[model samples]
Target: MGGPNLEVFKFGFYIMFPIGIMYYFGTNLDSKFSVDGFWPSKEQSNKIPTEPEDIRAELERLRRRRLERRATRLAEETRSQQDMAGDGA
Candidate 1:
């Protein structure tokens, strides 16, 4: 059976041990774990627009590009199907 002193020591050990370990190991963790080019550089980040209007315009441009690609793919599929039908006749 543990005494009050033992219980207090156990509590302090449980609390202090992990904090000490983190403090020792966490200091250089970012530099150690980070990969080169994984994060945007300052110039690349600066090119990204922070304004709501610019963000919306960028999104709209991407959406239009995606729709254009989809339309071109669908048209190609339709033309291929028509050519197959013409060949079968």
Candidate 2:
């Protein structure tokens, strides 16, 4: 290949190669900064609910919520029926 300025290109690579290698590894030379963010500082133990009374209370609350939702749906359905009857006139 009879390319002009080939010596300049060769010199540029020689100069930049060491800088690139340093940038790739020098800043992370410290072991502390090289790790990911998942290092734990606190207890990670799984906590299961320990009280039967708490479970019973939660169940009662959920049952109340379900009954309220059913009542609201039934009320809205009845209101839609009245609206349809009025529209048919």
Candidate 3:
């Protein structure tokens, strides 16, 4: 009565078989046919500032510009909506 049943082990393997095969082939194919954006190219790498202060300043500048642009866009959208509502009334 103490002997382990082999059916349980077979079922476990059956459940894992497809998952293991997929993981293996997926990683293999990813390595073999890696596209351009998988790793950054030289020009892409060059675009990043090397100094910490420069990186921070660049990020801050980008954030400020993005916020300004977003504010302007939101302002314009609201104005247009208001104009539409006024005309419809």
Q: Which structure among the candidates has the greatest lDDT?
A: 1
Clash pairs, candidate 3, are: none
Model 1 CA lDDT for position 44: 79
lDDT (C-alpha, whole model) for all candidates: 0.93, 0.83, 0.88
| Winning candidate number (TM-score) | 1
Give one digit per residue, the lDDT tens place, for model 2 in 19-80: 99888877757673666655665466544456998778877988999999999999999999
The list of candidate 1 runs beyond 4 A from truth reads 42-71, 83-89
lDDT for model 2, on a 0 to 1 scale? 0.83
Residue-level error in angstroms, candidate 2, position 14: 22
- The sequence of per-residue lDDT tens digits that candidate 1 reaches over residues 1-89 is 99999999999999999999998888898876788798898877757779999999999999999999999999999999999999999
Off by over 4 Å in 3: 1-47
Candidate 1 Cα RMSD after full superposition onto the native fold (Å): 4.9
What overall lDDT, based on C-alpha atoms, would model 1 receive against the true structure?
0.93
- Model 3's alpha-carbon lDDT is 0.88
